[model samples]
Target: MTNTNRASIKIGGGVNGSKVEGGKIRTEKSTSSTENNVDIIIDKDVTNSAEIIGGEIHVSSDLKAEIQELLNELAKNPITRKEAVAIEVIKEHINDNPSLKQRLLSALKAGGTEALKAIFNHPVVSVSVETVKGFLEAS
Candidate 1:
């Protein structure tokens, strides 16, 4: 199944950061010295099908499962000699798969850190995924 979504959004300002409140999106201009909060109300007609937790939007559980399944498939071919080397192997494996990288980036953007923790928490996959997660966040 495809995971594309479309939404009609109304933005009021040049938002650098955002949060959802009362089904509306509020934005803020991120700065080092002063914080400028701008409240941008979304249209009442606009609806979201994805899950939301603690004001953060997240991908569906099915998507998370799919990500886990793909990671498991990748993990089937072992390439770890030690704990440190295992992380590198996992990073290389993820980097080698464009589709997987795209899916992971999508999940990370949609679900934030919590979603990443849930997907990569598996004992066998955690180290590698964690390493990749750091790189993803940095970039």
Candidate 2:
């Protein structure tokens, strides 16, 4: 002979639902008493990433000469479409930021090497480098 206790415990609740034996269940979500009353803290890096490149350079003279030769080469020949697109993207970025323009002017006044260094690893510079390299290898 076997005996089975046939009991079904149906625990069904939505959101913050609860069940109890002859007790109240919220069945609703509770919101914070203090809504929209909060403070947000933000820590921003004000230092320019451009400065990092200049900090790493030990021989400015050699860098300046290399930059000058690159410019001379570009000036002496017609640029490929890839190079033109890269330059356009860079120009748009510089035009959008007045502070960048001022910083660029200052760097140029100090020396072309400093100016070159400022944008050394920038997205625009990366694009330009890859585009130029691709063109050179193709020719």
Candidate 3:
């Protein structure tokens, strides 16, 4: 039911010893393949489960101020976590190409946190952020 490789994760109706090239049966897994790869999936009948939460504004009042402060600081900084290896990759790209760094910063300023988080899971761009804000509406 879980794939620890992080290369891909799958939650099949039934568990298999190993994963193959990926056949049918509605995979609930995380795949890093940019070409039609998978990140998160649910096999339940529920449809239209995607939702978004505007940063800082989507959290509870009790934790709102703290989360906002965190967001403001992180929005203009570098990351430092082994799990966030993607950031290293991004840093490399930015080092080699400062223009890209500017471009991404510009995009972030324009799109705000929501878009940046989406880009992380998205293939075309690779940027991830913490302090996730769950959608106000149910997914």
Candidate 4:
């Protein structure tokens, strides 16, 4: 033989069916006492999330700086064969790492067409830029 026990929880007045609009959640309440008015507000910027290739991609600042350094190195005039190979390796790494690719795409989006041109003009780096372009086009 076995015994069964049950319990129920009941919640009282609260904000119901609240929806986020323009990156904000707002709720207001008032009591019989004039001083008892209550207000709740939350604010956030969702625009950046919309701009990113993937929903809210997060890359560390250090990684972003390091990638920028690599791009700057590639952009330098009279690049050597070793540097070209290194660029290829970087491309491979970007392809292998989704975060890095997202970071690259974010940088490109931030910099716009001029940045795209700069990357595309470099024969060694253009391959990776093309890959990024394909992602942009697909999205």
Tens-digit per-residue lDDT, 17-90, candidate 2: 22222111111112311111112222333233212111111223333343334444444544522456546644
Give lDDT tens digits, candidate 3, residues 11-123. Answer: 44432342323211111223321121223333433224433122211112222232233344444444522325545544454456555445445434443443334333422
Please identify model 2 stretches exceeding 4 Å from their true place: 1-81, 121-139
For all candidates in order, the CA lDDT equals 0.49, 0.33, 0.34, 0.41
Error of 3 at 96 (Å): 1.8
Best by TM-score: 1
User: All candidates' TM-scores?
Assistant: 0.44, 0.28, 0.30, 0.31
How far in Å is the alpha carbon of 99 misplaced in model 1?
A: 1.4
lDDT, residue 52, candidate 2: 15
Give the Cα error of residue 82 in candidate 4, in Å. Answer: 3.0
Q: In candidate 4, what are the lDDT values of residues 81-122, reduced to their tens digit? A: 245565565666677778767755764564433233333333
Best by lDDT: 1
- Clash pairs, candidate 2, are none
- Scored by lDDT, model 2 comes in at 0.33
Clashing pairs in 1: none
Off by over 4 Å in 3: 1-82, 122-127, 130-139
**What digit string (tens of lDDT, one per residue) describes model 1 on residues 1-139?**
2222222335554333344432211111222111112233444433354232234353445545665565566566665434476566556766787776677787767655445655554446545546667877665
What ranking of all candidate models by lDDT puts the best one first? Answer: 1, 4, 3, 2
